[model samples]
Target: MGGSYEDAIALLDTRRRVRRPSGALAKDAARDAGLKPEFRVGGEALRGKPGIVGMSGWMEELGHSPADVAALNIIHVAGTKGKGSTCAYIEALLLAHGAATGWPRSVGMYTSPHLLVPQERVRISGTAIDERGFAKYFFEVWERLFDGDTATESQKGERPRYLQLCVLVALHAFIKEGVGAVVLETHHGGEYDATNFVEKPVVTVVTPLGRDHVKQLGPGMKDIAWHKAGILKSGAVAISSAQEEGLEEVLRARAEERGVFGGDVKVVTGTEEPGVQGVKPDVQMGNCAVAVVAVRAFLERMRGEVLSEESVRRGVEGFKWPGRFQVVERGGGRERWWCDGAHNEMSIGVAGRWFVDGLEEGDRARVLVFSQISDSRDTEAVFRCLAESLKGSGVQLVIFTTYDPDQTFSASMSLDQQVATTTLPSLDVYERVWKELHPNAEVRFELQLAEALNLAKRIGEPGAGVDVLVTGSLHLVAGTLWWLGEGVGGAR
Candidate 1:
């Protein structure tokens, strides 16, 4: 007999024979009908568009249900740094309180770059939709938006973009799956970000803003702060980390102008022992405080008002975010490494201070495997801050490494200048460029990451105790972590 519904069911059954498979047949039928499990409403038409202002026009064309759109509970977060960590903490607290959550974060969490797996971007509760299911949703939404003929009003002036379509697919998935909340991390300035299209968020959180993304945002902190503050909605509560003197005022005025109450805007302050692994790092305490305040504000606005001081306390104390001063042991305790995503000068200074205070007297050599992109403003300043912070602290060695293969600009002279500016002799900046640029260089630059890490590990013996901090960019952290046998965790 020709392939019928029963045959499709059998195929699905074979795919899931190991599990208690019962939904196989229905799933297969959905796939056969051009409905993939994952949803990508726009496909490649939406990737890297200039701004979010144009997104509204495209969204209107999709004909998505207004009621479904209204049901979306969004938490929009934007800042120079700490945005990812804050989102992670908030997501974890909500999950603890029994709410289903979805996060749209940077980096390929579900999909690989340059690959055909579009479903990687649309994840339901941290799980990417399967291939068959992804195909089903892709076609189903495609047909609904643009009739099967692919010739209609939808075809006129329609552009193929990835980010725009990804947002649409995520929203559609959230509506279809009935998720209670969605946490969105903006790619750039919040004012024109696609996530801003969602109705005013219930709560908007701003982490510490600093000088970064100069090309898109601006050159200084004030300008960057304004762009980030654009996400604040009138009458919506806003929570922020303690800001610089002038920057705080700017954020406050913006919130006030929008009619967002000044009193409702809470700034995270004070400090408590992080209590993670029984090691109380000072920076962790500050982060914990900020998280606590944000969660309390969120719970206070809940319908039934179920949050309590004790519950909030427990949630904050129990929070653990990897890649933020994370220390992992490899090869059965023979080697140790620290991973942190501190890219900007302020964060780098903070990390340096934490190490200075935490390091024991007469510890083994301290090595830094650092790399950054060309766009990072004040690369020299960041290195100087770190070098100055470690002065007279008995740090044996500082290794400067480059990880980006496509970097057009070099910060080599910047590092050299910092050493002269600070007059610090204990710090040394090593460039991998000579080997990276040479056609016949003995060591491959890409593979040199492993060699650099292994060299650092070999330098210290167990008795002396060395600390290896892998930082600069999230890309570097991701690469190093993968090599060390640790999978990157959820959104943050």
Candidate 2:
């Protein structure tokens, strides 16, 4: 397959074969594919099979096996929120400590739903993979698994889903680059996630659990916890952040059944003061605590030594994960934009609280640009949670829009996003929900993201201070970042 980076992206786009079932069919599919089944919902099922059931076959097609995956010495992370940030903290700590240990020359991290490009999903030594490297490894995997024997000019054969293909490319690139360890974040659920194919991780971490991915994981928190805890190996240490009352029991039960290190799970509460600037005090500290505990466990359990406190502090302070709790000033400090990918009901509250807490006591016009693409989510409840957070702020403008930033930017929206946008009937729900909650505030819906941002900018023109919060969906955040020049090659 002779393909440039553009060609690679075009082919990758084809993998988003959306099959969204609804009504009774959705319920029946969920019952048959979720809860008792081993595979994730909506994955292309093998004939007579429940789900993908172990990504081993896909790995073998790419010339990798369980043994190969285990060699990466992965630190598996799964949860409803903070997975990416936790992984970022872990990678930073490992890099800060690796110099002294002289063991790991490089560390690789694999996370989902990139902010700008697909290459952002794979990072080595805390840097995103460049275009050349991305295309090189992408086609290598494509040739083996997607493109059949080239000698006979056979048509493109079977292919993994878009997210599945990204995982394979990251793993292959990590192996080729000779990284000593990989911090792997679960795509969604853990039981049958493509990343769960790793035979064993040195340690397994579960961030704070909440109601998310209900279509695939649950209608309840317990159901979601069961799927998340599936990442814990038989002998690996399971580290978790403080969860709701009785939720820890669910994790412990899963650990006991999975035989994880005598069924003992370590629960950690964050430091009173995180000592990190430009980070939220409550949520960031909790995520930091989980990361610190995970790194300490990996070192003490695997290397038989404890990490230095100084290294831990430096790592935490230096950690950076874009498109989540990110702040940027544009138009010569005349306008400010706060971006966070808070998609679920639980996280929307967190994002709102953070925004409210961080606001300066000024008469700046507050504008909200938001959108949610998940049909499984309760848009009204999520908007209500946000409304509660914004009760005190004099926010009178709310703009709901699609994720596509600009119609001319062909690569702005991913294939999955395109499908989701088409499925979304309209923004009437968002407008109606805001009207019911904030009766006096104004609400606007824009089909194009560029128009939304323009409207936001116009609401708070230059020379007049205005604070804008962009939240709800990661795709929306990504587009905002592109427009704001805050991503990849863009300016801060």
Candidate 3:
């Protein structure tokens, strides 16, 4: 019945000690240890467990002050996609200005489906919290939640332990590190999300909203947009990307209704005078413009503050994020690989357009190795977009692979089934229109990434332009990276 900090550490350590290295074995051990058996956002198991619907009540009970929390000077971002990239840019800008920064992002940034080491979920200044610090803070927070009680009457159906614990731990780490600015990327709808407990933020940024997480949020764009817009507070600036057709109007109306100044809500479409990076890529304009506007708004709010425009520009231009249009060079002058996390239809179309229009004729061969989770909406459309974009680009095979079966939301299916059902049909539709438009192009699909990459390497005619693109899901990119000897940081 003892629930002391020491006891909790010993318990967690014992649980870890007994888990095997293989995923299946570890899952079994977790079930045996009475852990929930279902999956959670960060790739942790939460089978048959209750979830915290909202953190508002909990934050209030803890006597946490929003003003004191705002004193940490944080920017909160929520979106279905681009949240991680945006957060990375903001963090980089703050770091360039010599401010201590803490960023908690989704999908292997802060937490992942599995943790090879626990410290990856909590970090300060790009370094994981040491084991001692992790244990110290984790137990300190856990004891407070349990109130150092022993054998208290067990609540029949209390909040699941993991979600509650993660919120407390994150808050504790942010406070302990004395982070000057913390950038948080939220999961699910913003209003009820764990991070929503914070009081009025300086600025809330929303990236483009699309059809995703339909089961949890809703089926329509308006519903999803409303959920994302939940972060906006009266008088706080709200920034968003230029929407498609009526979407922008919907957002503008919402912000107006909330009494936020009309000028405070900025919608970015494209930028003039393209800036030169080491490489020129498509979507660079949109991404850069969004980052620039958001950063400017935040800085303007702190007018008398010490942030400078030059430093902000430097931070935005110099920020680096892997697996989001990342181009890695191979040894021996082999084909280069472009890795991205364009799992949805819109993103794939954007990437395809970039490759076709940006790359020079003699630069690199474009070969796509794509895979996605089964539960993804309109994946067939995504494949079609990629194919249409690369119609006349001399692009080679479109290799199709299955994402990690363990971490995906959909039921497991064979690689062949995935290609036969989704990728193949999409390719056929793409070909029917493509052949009439351009008869010189060809598209084929393979069931394995390794084989596809090997084929691409062999098909390269020595000096011929050859670039391999691996994308679809973050898991697919992470898996390919692991095979290529790159460290999957969260997976150790």
Top candidate (lDDT): 2
User: Which order, best to worst by TM-score?
Assistant: 2, 3, 1
Model 3 scores a C-alpha lDDT of 0.57
Q: Model 3: which residue pairs collide?
A: 36-47, 37-47, 38-47, 42-112, 43-113, 364-465, 364-466, 365-465, 365-466, 365-467
Which whole-number lDDT from 0 to 100 does residue 235 have in model 1? 62
lDDT of 3 at 71: 65
| TM-score of every prediction relative to native | 0.69, 0.88, 0.71
Please report the TM-score between candidate 3 and the true structure: 0.71
TM-score of 1: 0.69
Which scores better on TM-score, 1 or 3?
3
After best superposition, candidate 1 residue 282: deviation in angstroms?
A: 3.4
Best by TM-score: 2
User: For residues 186-232, what per-residue lDDT tens digits would candidate 1 score against the true structure?
Assistant: 76566556566655666787887887766556656777787788788
lDDT of 3 by residue, 249-298 (tens): 76777778776645457777666422313224545555556666665666
User: Model 1, poorest ten-residue lDDT window?
Assistant: 107-116
